[model samples]
Target chain A: MMVSNDDAALVVERIGPQALVEDSGRFGVRHLGVTQGGALDWVSLGWANWLLGNAPGTAGVEIAIGGFALKAEASMTLAIAGGDLGATLDGAPLPPNGAFAIERGQTLAFAQPVAGLRAYLALPGGVVAAPFMGSVATVAREQLGGLDGRGSALAGGDRLLAAGTCAAPREMPMAPALPREDVALELVTGAQIGHFEGASLFATFNSPWQVDTRADRMGVRLTGPELRCQLGGMISEGIPLGAVQVPPDGQPIILLNDRQTIGGYPRLGALSPLACAALAQCAPGTTLTLSPITPHQARRRYLATLAQWR
Target chain B: MSDAQIRVSEAPVIRLETVGMDALMVRLFDAIDEAHMPWILAADRALREGFGEDLVDLVPSYTTLLVNYDVERLDQREASACIRDALIGLRPASTAAGREHRIPVWYDESVGPELPRIAERLGVSCEEIIRRHSERDYCAFALGFTPGYAFMGMIEEALATPRLKTPRQKVAAGSVGIAERQTAIYSMRSPGGWNLLGRTAVKLFDRERDDISLFRPGDRIRFEPITRDVFIEQGGDTTPLEERG
Candidate 1:
């Protein structure tokens, strides 16, 4: 059940739902105007690495929706975290948020999620992949960051190889998975918050919004009451991640990791990082509410969350 | 960072807000203007210099600079304070004017697909439309939509045209088009709705070239017209400019 030092390849047995090699994200190249293409749910990506005693930003696999299956060519220790997409190894159900050992020639498979949309798979060390703009996060649209450094998603017959040596098998206590359904995302109103009509503002915070089918790494479209703004014909400006932009159609689109650098649409505000993580796992038709909070409160909550993970 | 040399100006329009746990947006004045561009550039340069590696990235737009940092190492208050101080010390003298590039374009019917429609809308002959468009110098206002895509501003008032009602699913690379007050060259083949008037044989974006993008914000551009045969002879397949430098 051991892989020889010269044997570096891990063969694929089955390709379930969706699996793509990912890392912290591409950075330092935005000055060249490249988007920071990375995992849609970075918090979960970090947690998955932490579970395996690897650097939080190490490259791993991001399995969306979950029906991915893989066979190990060599014995290895792996950790699965983020999203409770039912995962199993060789017909035995495996729990999320902990590390396990897989022997050579064994198969690992994931089924449709019972909760959450993205799941992370981390090897003992990290996934071996070439860096594109200083990251291995796969961004298919930009044609950057992937296993081959071409930003292609995982297709059938794709092979994954782990980098570095495997650590001794260890058992780490698992944390309770958060409630993904009926989650309330927190918002910190932007400078343009005052421009929105009072009624629209009220509806924004009070009304329930449904995630529209038009969702991607770039942004998520929300179907809810039209948000009217007082300002018309405003100049286009640099939009931030999580900025809830209200275009001419009045529907709100929350920009995400792969959003364009700038936008002209008026924005109600930006959702906090934690809120974005929660929203990232939500499927189309899932309802969400926006709760406004002060910047101070948002910062405190974000710091607290990070501290817990650390 | 020392405060002695820092000069401060009140940017009433620029709003400072937390974007995420780790990012903040230092928005310039609400609207885009020639005066604001210098300030935005200076502030961005100053902050990068002041923070060094602490700053994750600085994204500059026509009127805003989004600064991303590491939350584990820096917080909103510390980052905001540093940025505000840097903004106050920002001097217009430090902002370097972006390089100017001249692009040759063929404005004839074969190259300029929308020439006739633009001429009819402006009540001018097709020749006059091309003459006016080629004569006026354009400033690169920003770059976005796709890699190497430069958004130039203040097209000739007469030649100013609206975008097409239905955007073309695939615009050829090096296609020069106009939309309202902005003129742009499509760096790569992609969907676009602008009014196409010409194509350039010169590569606007070549990944392999040391200068991947021919134009940057603040660069001046002029279009030169040439015949169709010469364009094909130049080995222009509109393939993406490979990264060389």
Candidate 2:
């Protein structure tokens, strides 16, 4: 099977709670006080693009808790990955992490999530849009970079286009190892790690943290143990992705891609990127535990994961 | 870049610590002051000159410069060591240049949601409150909490107030506010607790503008008090500013 240059177009029939155009991430502009707006699950975006023989960092659509439907305006090969969003093409099942062609009248619909919270849809030449700040990653809060270059979620009647062209279909040599059933997130102990009292530390590691309903692309609020950090009022500081910050209320907020550029809260540390990807896939009420990994260990794991893309 | 006065031995020793696996923070002070800006700016320059591509992004806030790096090229230990050494060699900011933007603000009882209450609490008149607030020329220290939301300040000590007892459910974008030493514009309609001073006619952030960010670090801001008529004359969309063109 191969992709075609038949002006492949996707028309949004029904949009989910959220659907966005995303690349790997917007880099080198964090100093401009811009947040890195990209795929919450970078791993899945890579795999979707890879299935279409596109570069790993190419743009794709990120559908959250799918209730989305798209009608193909022109026949083209596309790929999907991430959480099983219970997708079906013309009522037939479309499995994840595989590429297939769709006819002009075919309708691809995704119901509620089966396992994962997000699904990525990728095309041969990737979705084409003018770049803002050198990226097309949709940041709803920032209102920058989307199909319209205005950062709005996929709306009904919107037409999606790719640099549609023919390319040889490629299959994954082997699928990456899926995350374990018991979700154990890994965080590297850093800034203000010593500031937390031993009791809080004990609770942090031992207790199961529940993902609060207040979770979003900005960050996930973990509610369970009130972690006390022994520090005076903090001056605002740069916040990295997955930084586990404890505010005055003692609840921890694990910041993500759409998080603000800086914050003034004491932090326990930042979670590994892989752990963040896992956390992104989690729905509200999901209980997970934080496992401390050395920075060295995190580097090895992150690089090893990136190695699979090429 | 060359015209800086940084000395290795005389400068205060900067602490290099970890914010996360991918980021190394070079902290200069616990809190921020005008004195710290030069040091922070200098350190930022030194790091950019020193590490180059290994440095992914450097986010400078009031007290710390958070450096995100490629873990493959520079691990945590090396990044910290490199930052620690670079801090010693950081050059002092030499006549750092920044733009001066005079924003038009309508300071009226009706214009400011919390002005009357803040005036009563401070035992001052609403006019007096506006006078002290618009008098000082505050610098943009950092942007965070939200996109295009600039944390610019060093407000007059007498006018400084703590965050609202309970933050407002929503603060309109372009609303000017003060909380403690910091004064800022609520660029987006986000929940904020700052004492609302007034609203500005000019949107602080507009994606349609040539420069997406109106306020940058080191930039000076002065509020030009305008009449209500002038505020309306300029597209007075008092609703929250959406991040759009």
TM-score top scorer: 2
Question: What is candidate 2's TM-score against the reference?
Answer: 0.91
lDDT tens digits, residue span B77-175, model 1: 888887877777456533235554667776655545788888988788988887888776666667777766777777766677778888877777888
**Model 2 residue A279 distance off true place after TM-score fit, in angstroms:** 1.1
lDDT of 1 at A226: 90
Least accurate 10 contiguous residues by lDDT in model 1 chain B = B236-245
Best by DockQ: 2
Query: Candidate 2: which pairs clash?
Result: B6-B92
Ten contiguous residues minimizing lDDT sum, candidate 2 chain B: B1-10
lDDT of 2 at A6: 35
Give the TM-score (0 to 1) of chain B in model 2: 0.85
Ten contiguous residues with the weakest lDDT in model 1 chain A:
A1-10
